[model samples]
Target: MTDEPRLSAQDMIERLGPVLSRRTRIRAVTALLAGVAGAVFVGTLWWSEPGPLPGRTHLAFALFTMFCLTWAGYGGWLVTRRVALFATDRVIAAWIGLAASLATTAVIIVVAVQRGTSVGLALVVGGLFVAVALVLAVRAHARRAALLRRMHELSGREER
Candidate 1:
């Protein structure tokens, strides 16, 4: 008797469904999200009030938020089209890291400006954010490299 185990129909469907879904519609979904984020960013810029301490902070936060949303959406769109499921984990991790860094930096800058924080203190805070971001980005890059190596090994085996 053959040693290969047979997969049931449900098992096959479960295995293949995600591959098919990723190949078919991931790019479209990312694009739609990008468009929506861009629209919201614009809307916030056009409509948010601008006349107080909190308003100033809000505006600064909004700018950073816009950058985060646009970058994530656009990057997701690009990565999905090219990498499919290969490097998505790396990309998402990097995006989260960057968003955290930028948001932290922006908030610090806003608060510093609003409350007249000393330059030394602001610099220290900024440094902390940078350190955290660097760590996260490096981890993500390592993870991606590992994944790429695995894919390369699998492909080489298939050729043999």
Candidate 2:
């Protein structure tokens, strides 16, 4: 009998045997979702409400809803992809949440710069959005890293 462990989908890819197994399909889906979320967020700025004061105090939140949806779509993609790979949904949700928050912030900045009546005030408004986005992104990244580590441990155990 052979002493080698049974070859898995990942192993098949290494041998160049039609690399796109179910697992690869999942990862690719996650990556594609992330890319799509980012693109939608950057592209959606044209619809934000212009403001005289350039602050959230007056801006409507319909655009914000879109941002959240984009994020959710990405997360769903990630989870589905991960499920296909190793049956784990770790870090996928976090990635989507982070991308959504940042995209919303970007939209706010665009609105402030292009639609705000005052240039100086618009910069201040945009700056605040950037700061918030930075904090959210950092938090999301940290959380995702932790979850990914846990997933790795679980996956290792499964292999054994």
Question: Quick one: best lDDT, which candidate?
Answer: 1
The parts of candidate 1 lying over 4 Å away from their true place are 1-46, 50-62, 71-83, 92-96, 99-116
19-125 per-residue lDDT for model 2 (tens digits): 34667567657655755665466446534536453455334344554554555565556545422333233345444555655555566566656665445654566
Q: Assess each prediction's global lDDT (C-alpha) against the native.
A: 0.63, 0.54
Question: What TM-score do all the candidates reach, one by one?
Answer: 0.52, 0.35
In terms of TM-score, how similar is model 1 to the real structure? 0.52
lDDT value, candidate 1, whole model: 0.63
Tell me the lDDT of candidate 2: 0.54
lDDT of 1 at 49: 50
- Candidate 1, pairs of clashing residues: none
As a whole number from 0 to 100, the lDDT of residue 93 in candidate 2 is 43
In candidate 2 the C-alpha lDDT for residue 108 amounts to 57
